[model samples]
Target chain A: MSLHLQPVRVATSSDDSESQLVFAEGFLVAMLVHLSEQHEDDAGRWFLEAGFGRIPSRDHPTFLDLDEAQTWIRQQLGNAYVS
Target chain B: MASNFTHPLFPLIRKLDSIATLTDEERQAVENLPVRIRALRARHEIVRHGEKASQCCLILEGWACRSKVISEGKRQIFSFHIAGDIPDLQSLHIPLMDHDLCTLTQATVAFIPHEAVRDLTMRFPSIAAVFWRDTLVDAAIFREWMISMGRRTAFDHLAHLFCELYLKQQAVGLAGEHRCPLPITQGDLADATSLSNVHVNRVLKEMRGKGLITLRSNTLVIEAWDELIRAAEFDATYLHLQKRAVP
Candidate 1:
């Protein structure tokens, strides 16, 4: 009936990996490049063909490890915020 | 109590064994936390929603799944709990569960009370860090799985899940290169992958058809592991489970 909204950092609940760090800063540009070119077409479908679904292939850009993924995410934030 | 923890996650927890040099009493104190054990059959709810956050259940054996119930009776599974996984570790702060914790197979779990954990962390600050890292890793997994379910195709999710399990089980000394036994069903996977059961079945047949893996019984024999790993794009950095074997 009512809501239990608290102060929790809500990440993206969409089929887009770019949701993880969207609001922080220049990630907007990276995500724009990410969502438009790669995920909008068949490159995204390859993951479905493989059986795993829901990863925004385009946003990731590369199949990097988690550490590297985090690094790239931080860089996106730092570059965007610093500039 | 015997100090040699024969639990499967011992290797994983042992990796956080920076307190090995503690005195005998301290070692015993850390190792002697009251552990409540529970065994569950397939497709059981180990813990349900709306219940107060209580003891953290450390998964000792078998497979389990954590999911959230959405509209239209659909379930979105966050992670599969295998040997050595503390499925309820995230209960540290959340007052009540926002999702359901269920078992997908006959499982063994040890209930470590929150107070005990808090007290233990008080004595050993690194325990908190280790567990904080553990929960952070769990959050990382949720993020990755969410990425797959939100963006990738069905096949990549399956491949990624298999690679994930193989590596996760291996960290706990439960798996090897060629064959890894996972007690999972297609319906369970369908809930996990956010796909229809029929779709999961069709794609599994395709994966087998393409010689990526061989599924017989409940176990999986990865005939071409490198191919499967590549297909899933699996990397082991997330696991962070490299325990120096005992001397």
Candidate 2:
């Protein structure tokens, strides 16, 4: 199943507020925040702000773009469903 | 005796003196203790987990840390040590190291034999008491860390750590005027505080934005010490430094 990403703003209490809400089969699966300029080298990267349903909180990962994030999210969701 | 008192092992005396009063004889005994000195490169492991250690490492210069690695290379740093700290003092009694101890920066360290330490303690009960007191304070610091990990927000937890680091240095005359060396990298802070690197970066920026502190060139200057302490609700009482360093 393909993932749907809805562009949104997150109040992360920091400069990195631009975010996206991901949906898998109409169920919200994760939220990703865009790293702000304050992050220096990591700026412009997308960070997994939160993940639900077998996507552990400990895996706070950063991706190069939304495409990579969605792909990773799909993998996580796919693993969750298979297992 | 004065010339001998100016020994390389003087940092140990200073460290112990920071916690409790050391009589002349006690100080002399420590100064006279034989130590094999070595200059270690940054990140060099001094004692590995499960290794039976025959000696303890004392930090003569720079910094070190006690840490353990779990599955997938995730490291949890238990404590950051500075000059005068015996990072593996427990190894004197325990022999087997439970966590790995390593230098955080290029460091000068003195290795003190366990036999000598045990003999010294056996002869000087007061020195032994001070050592016991040191371990107790170490446990107290751990309790604070537990609170930060379980309850405090990332911002508060980091603030508390900064305060602790500054005061610890100040007590030993290594720091003053709300300023201290912060040579540790952001990644190290993440491991110590149980936060992600991204999270640590954000908190540090927030701290900078709010004018709480300025970390530059491996130095941390607490610009708003009062406000920071208030925000973190830091109580120095837990540190139990007998001669509390003037902040």
Candidate 3:
């Protein structure tokens, strides 16, 4: 479902916030949310909107780095490039 | 009128602008085509993974499903293609298809040859943008589906999908008053949400018991909008139609 326009989307310093997360279109929002909540510092700080009514975090698994994280994210999004 | 497919789905292509660009006499030169129409029974496979795609399949009738399978046979459905959808336009570029498309209801479709579609696009550039943007919107819809299937819960997933299909079909004048044609079965719903059939059935019952939604005879009537939207945690930004209004 997630198709990249560039080879890899480089996250700029400007993009290092919850507000810019709005620009992260489509399934990318879901991917970043996983990375942000699980990876903590590596992912980015979360912006909680009282609107989103989930348990926030349930499985307290150790978070992954960027490269490894993107793989898991892409898998969740159902990439044709991967299995 | 030989051509009447001018709708909001055609991006960057103005309907009135097209009138001056192409004359009715010249437009008439290309045949409107009497195409062969076929019917697909509910839940029947119209196209499967690895099948050679040759025709431009247009969903002229009921709702249909498109999905892909993952490792350990985990299935993830991309999105539903309703009327006016050419579900496989991107398949032309990829050569081999990696997913399956099936009818969720007793559906009817018009098949146009690939070559004819290319010719048709060349002949009608305005309509071409419409189809291309339709494909772009199709990709956007997949992005939303990916979110629901991968992250959202069973009830949330169903609610988000219901909201999405209702809005999309409404745009085309196919849906009305929170009532929409949804022929998807509980099993099919499970496949889309990445949940078990029992889970899907239970979720449906829960929603119905809460009086949030109702499903009977292939039609879904959403009785509570705010409750359903809150359950799904869905926002409509991904569809990207807002770019048209920024001026």
Best of the candidates, DockQ: 2
The CAPRI category of model 2 is medium
Per-residue alpha-carbon lDDT of candidate 2 for residues A1-83, written as tens digits (9 for 90 to 100): 67788999988778888999988878888889999998888999999989888666776889999989888888787745522
User: Candidate 3: TM-score?
Assistant: 0.63
Model 3: per-residue lDDT, tens digit, B1-247? 4134552222112222222243464344233533467888887887789998887677777878788877666666777877767787776566477889888788887776777777766777755655666667677877787787678877788889888878776656678899988877766777777665444555676788899998898889999988888888868776654324110
What's each prediction's TM-score? Answer: 0.67, 0.95, 0.63
Q: Return whichever of 2 and 3 wins on DockQ.
A: 2
- TM-score, prediction 1: 0.67
Q: What is the C-alpha lDDT of each candidate?
A: 0.63, 0.89, 0.60
User: Mind listing the fnat for each candidate?
Assistant: 0.00, 0.50, 0.00
Q: Please provide the root mean square deviation of candidate 2 (C-alpha atoms, Å).
A: 2.8
Q: What is the DockQ of each candidate?
A: 0.02, 0.69, 0.02
Cα RMSD for candidates in order: 14.6, 2.8, 15.1
lDDT of 1 by residue, A1-83 (tens): 11111122222222333322222322122222112122333222212111111223322233323234444445544433333
Candidate 1 C-alpha lDDT tens digits along B1-247: 2435764445335434531233455456656788777777877887788888778887777787888887657778878887666788778677488788888888887788888878887887656666687777787787888878887778888888888888776665677876888788777888888875545665677688789888888898888889987888877676666542221
